[model samples]
Target: MRSAIHEFPDDLFTNNERKSGAVLLHITATLYMFLALAITCDEYFVTSLEKICEKLDLSEDVAGATFMAAGSSAPELFASVIGVFITHGDVGVGTIVGSAVFNILCIIGVCGIFAGQVVVLTWWAVFRDSSYYTLSVVALIAFIYDEKIVWWESLVLVIMYAGYILVMKFNSSMQRFFMGKSSKNVANGNAATSSEMEDVKPSKAYSRGSVVMVDEMMNASPSKFRFPEAGLRVMVTSHFGPKTRLRMASRLIITERQKLVQAANGVETQVIDGKVEIENGTVPEDKPTEAEENDTISPFHIPRGVGSKIKWLISWPLLLLLFFTVPNCAKPRWEKYFMLSFILSTVWIAVFSYLMVWMVTIIGYTLGIPDVIMGITFLAAGTSVPDCIASLIVARQGLGDMAVSNTIGSNVFDILVGLGVPWAMQTMCVNYGSEVMINSRGLVYSVVLLLGSVALTVLGIHINKWQLDFKLGVYVIVLYAVFLCFSIMIEYNVFTFVNLPMCMEE
Candidate 1:
């Protein structure tokens, strides 16, 4: 099928007159897609997500599992839509499958290796998310096994996601039901431990035992902390996930860091009741502080260092483009128009996703690469960067459960909502009773491998005593490398000819 975005006949290789230019354009298109996704996710998508959470008074756990997951997984969803409707191939499925593996193996691996110390995970949280994720993957494998998806199958996937959402909605209840403990007791214990630890200095590094201690202290109860002036926290306590809490902590750190920068340039700092406060900005009676207002777009500002300057300079065009096109919900001016920002960001994500798929399909065709292979490799990694970065950040903060749950939970969203919605639209609505075809048999193998990766990762974490550290990181990373190798080889017919050779013009 000819791509709607392709200007060249057949592919870049088919036309000598503009072959080189076409190739370069496609390459640039792919890179631009990455930049576009990153900008949209960071600046607009997540900020809008926070706004929705605040507006709806949703819990952090529910919001993170649903809105945050959906927001971050938007690109993959759109890519799957493009793959099914436009490309009529396996690219979308391949991307989702590959991305699932990457999320499970590669991201966790990186977090483990670079998190600076052992970070103990909450077993129940990991188990809950991973179990649901496994079922989702299994459902995907079952649906795609025969290389066709019918209306009912798509419906099943969508319904499965609905069930997952419901589970997240009652996460605390489920935790209590399964763990045999009420959240109130846990919450109370957490409050006492947190207050005691408030005066203690954070240790430089955590050993395995210290990691367990930290995990116990942190997981003892839901945090009652609120950043009222920062405007990130809600009234919800037990619902806060590690990711949400970590972001709040990051906001405070950023404020302190900003104050330090200001002090270096001669801004005065005041010590009030043994706490350091900057005099440059004051928290308004009801309005968010300067730090809260710039929470999302703070990095867009030109900073004081050469490397940071260069990075900001490179990102300036994207920043400017997004700034004009989408409302910045984090800004005081557009604070109330978060829904508008969410809609606009989602639209941009769809556009970027379409361009990404279109370019990758053409490039693969030109270079004689199978769509599945391109999808599994390039598209997967490109789309998953946001999740990877988020997981790594939280992991470094010693929010191992948050990091692990995010990775696994996003996979669930990707498999169920990301792929499911598109399939449902095609079969149930777009063309009634129609079936979407899976172009490559290799994708089934890849998905099975994806399931295996999840099992192995969970097993590895369990074996490591639920601690994410350097050894487990290396293990999962090696698993990721091995997965990529096997997937590529399978697509290339090294093990079996499951995919047809890309048709090329002479």
Candidate 2:
């Protein structure tokens, strides 16, 4: 029951036997520092992934959901692995399960509230993803119902993840096939695609693309932590960096083609002298303005003051930050680099996670609190910071599907690959025996809560004509809060019921 960390004598780190403001300050400062680093790395991560998605010509929703989702959730994954290694109470399983629950309920909920309404471009995609995710969760629950993980069960989860990829591939191929249907269908498809594009027009910051966004709070809160500029950059840049000029150029190239399509649709087509023509009579098609051409403009925004410029001024200038992602300016447009940056960022997140855990432990020790409680509440939540950042960026970019998908994607990756692969290797590797214990009562309820949240989200989209709105967001957040309360109670022995009984009889 004892861990090395727990063996340290009281006042080992300090002479005083009582909690001190110094400890509080150390914890507070470290957490914020970690937050700043995490937020910055997250900016670069999303930037790189967006470029990768664009270059590969992949569906933002599917790509973001699976690849980017797994990438962003990397922090929680590593944290869980390490948590178990450190012999923290149920750290591995608790973090993954808790993080999954947090993603579905908190991250998705936040995205919904931000957009006011997060619409699904294809409810079919939603259903398709939901089905696989539900399958994975059910399988995991079945495996863990025995209060232990076995080699075969872990293998099944890993296999299930591979299947998820195959299914996604099939779905993407079908979408492409449909796009290549009749000419009429092709035009319709383009129209549908436009809905998925995160345009600058909808956001209040640009104010219909002409108004320069001005600061409302005179001095602009400039804390390095308040990286408003980072959010703004999401509009003007991609993973490759500042694409304003490139987008305009690309738009010009597509303009002539768009004109022909308009003529086919009879929007401005005319016949004179036995020849077809475009008449300026019916106003010419309006092209996106220079400001609007930037991709990062979304309906939601995080405010920043000019003070952040101090951060830009001292270390790396804003322009330098812009150039950092530019493919030509820095690295070549290789998939490996984007992938590498993502991998490194996850590692960075993992390193910061140790800091977070250590700080939380110190705080708990000072307060004479239990390790299990701290692991579940503080450490579990801390490790999910990347998911919080990545999903918000995706959502703000108007890829509502990707934003929501990432939540599902992250949870799926967390449960299956995160827990699965590690356990698979551990259990299958011979002579080393194991007795991995989980809180039976809490584990059962967590699975139920997870399944219910996923089902409710899918049903809400179905009921609202495949649209996600603030009401659903509110519901999920409330659901998560209730679940948290029940979990705390169960942990404290105030409530008790577990799913192992059914397995016991079997």
Which candidate leads the pack in lDDT? 1
TM-score for each predicted model, relative to the true structure: 0.83, 0.63
Model 2: per-residue Cα lDDT over 369-403, one tens digit each? 44445655665676676666555544443445545
| TM-score leader | 1
TM-score of 1: 0.83
Cα lDDT of all candidates, in order? 0.72, 0.52
lDDT score of residue 478 within candidate 2: 85
Residues 339-381, candidate 1: write the lDDT tens digits. Answer: 9999999888988887788788777766678888888889989
Model 2: colliding residue pairs: 47-239, 220-305, 222-308, 234-296, 235-296
